[model samples]
Structure formats: structure tokens, C-alpha cells
Target: MPLLILGLLVWSVPHLFKRLAPEMRAGLGDKFKGVVALLVVAGVVLMVIGYRGAEVVPLWYPPSWTMHLTDLLMLFAVALFGLGNSKSRLRGRLRHPMLLGVITWAVGHLLVNGDLASVVLFGGMLIWAVLSIFAINAREPEWERWQGGSVAGDIRLGVITVVVYAAIAGIHYWIGPSPFPM
Candidate 1:
């Protein structure tokens, strides 16, 4: 849908701006962060509105087994998202943990959702994540690996991941069709 496409563009453009046009983004300075945040929020709103309103044009029906894989991937995605911010030893394992989480989430959703709107939403996010990874790597080739985090940090991350995952599942249940397979 047009709104969905527009939402994707609105969300991605601000994110890619700093990577693509460093000078222009830098010119705006820290103040630009607020503007970018607002744009991202608006983009999410548009995407939700578009996705809900779009007609279901199914491309292919996914196998029932895909639901299990989707759940597994979603759990891993949540862990990766928490891993990025946690002071755990594993923090250094991946340079772009949160972006990787996004990729995982998108892939998981794509596995179960074969409709046009879902593809446009999840697939667009996948493309954006890949592009973002490429852009970040091109800009900063060197990475300083993290060190010296204790196991306690990992324990904390695990707890947080569980909480967040439950919250997400709750939201999905509250909204409409639940993510859980019958």
C-alpha cells in the first residue's frame, strides 16, 4: 500500500541519512536526534495504519511447522536485542546485535506471513537492516571489541529478555491474532 511504502521510507530515510550524508546529518548536530525520533514514531504509526487497512493478498500459505521456527527465531531475536545493551561478555561477539535482532525478527515474521502487506513491512525491514549494516561497516571498518564483563551481566540480560519477550507476546495477544500457534 502507498501508506506502508511511505512509512517504510519515512522510517528508513532518517536512519540512513547519517550514514549516507554524514555532512548534512552532522550539520544538524545532537538536536537532529529529536527530529529523527519523531519521524521514526510517525513512520511506525503510518505502517500500523497501512498494514491493518491493506487487503490480504496471500502469496503462499506457510506450513504449520513454520510457526515453531518463527517462535524460536522470535526468542533469539529478543535475546539479541537485549545482548546489544547488556554488559555481558557476549556483547563483543556481534558488532551489530540490535540490527541483527531486527533481521531475525523480520525473517521470523516472513516465515509465517505470506501476504503482500506483511512482505512489504517485514521484507522492507530486512532490506533496511542489511543496508544499515553495510553502511555502518563502510563508515567504520574498525571495531573495538568489548571486554571484561561478568556473568552477572549475562544473567541480568537473560532475565530482561524473558520479561521483554513475555511483554511482546502479551501485546500480540491483546491486539489481534496471537503469535502463539494453537
Candidate 2:
């Protein structure tokens, strides 16, 4: 738990620093990017180790039906993630597709995982994404939507979304706790 909290802080603080302390971040210049990258990697390692070793303190048992909703949410989350990087017309409509995807992913995980570690991990990420969105919006209120997206881009996005989502599911199944509902 301590490690988990520490990892969350390490992961989130660096992300929030630039937004919260623009002058400080600017002072560091481009060199800080490497440091931030290292910190993020370390944070991820700590989080994985902490979460796996943490005592499983069950909070509430989610119903089997919630898995369906989780699956649906995950599918949408994947699509949202793809929309963020794709040149699709829909990409322009959203201001923060990646953060929205993170929020969706966290919510989906929270629906099926009702434990202390799970909450700390997923809920923390959810808070981080929401905070990032707020910080970005506060910094820049005006949003300039993307332009020149074509139908081919939308088709590409759809294909990639499906492939990535399937790959994620496959990885989950290969590792532990199969994502598919029993």
C-alpha cells in the first residue's frame, strides 16, 4: 500500500508539475523530459510490485453482470484512445480524448474490481486524468479543433481500435485474471 501510494504520487506529480508550475518546468528546459520519463518508468514498476504484493482487502463483490458493462466501457475506452491519435473527423470533436479514455478505462476496471488495491490504482488514475483535463482546460480555454480529417482516417481508426482492443484482451488472458466473463 505504501509503495502503491508512493508510485501513484511519483507518476502523477511529474505529470501535474508542468501544468501546475509552468515557470519551474520551463526553467528545467528539455533535459527534464528524460528525467520525467525515467520517473514514470520507475513509478510503473513500483505500482506493479506494490499492487501485486498488497493484501487483498475486499471491499464489495461486484455482480457478474457488471462485467458486461465493463466490457462495453473498455471497448469505448479503446475507441476513445484511438480517436485521440487518429486523423478521423471525430478526433476534432473531442478536446481530450486520451484523458477521457483513461477515465473510461478506470471506471470500467472499478466496476469489476472492488478492492482496496484496485481502488488505489484505478481510482488514482481516474483522479489524475480528471485533474489533467482540468489543468489543461484552465491553462487554455480556447480549443482549436482538428481539421482535414478524411473518411480513410476514420476507417483506419476503426480497424486499429479493434486490433488494439483485441490485443489488450489477449494480453490480459495470457497474464492473469481473464478479462472475458465466465
lDDT (10s digit) by residue, model 1, range 1-182: 88999999999999999999999899999999999999999999999999999999999999999999998899999999889879888999899999999999999999999999999999999999999999999999998987767799989888899899999989999998788999
Error of model 1, residue 4, in angstroms: 1.0
Model 1 C-alpha lDDT versus the unseen true structure: 0.94
lDDT accuracy of residue 139 in candidate 2? 95
Clashes of 1: 0
Q: How far is candidate 2 from the true structure (C-alpha RMSD, Å)?
A: 0.9
lDDT against the true structure, each candidate: 0.94, 0.94
What TM-score, to 2 decimals, does candidate 1 have? 0.97
Q: What is the lDDT for 101 in model 2?
A: 98
List the candidates' TM-scores in order: 0.97, 0.97
Model 1: ten consecutive residues of lowest lDDT: 143-152
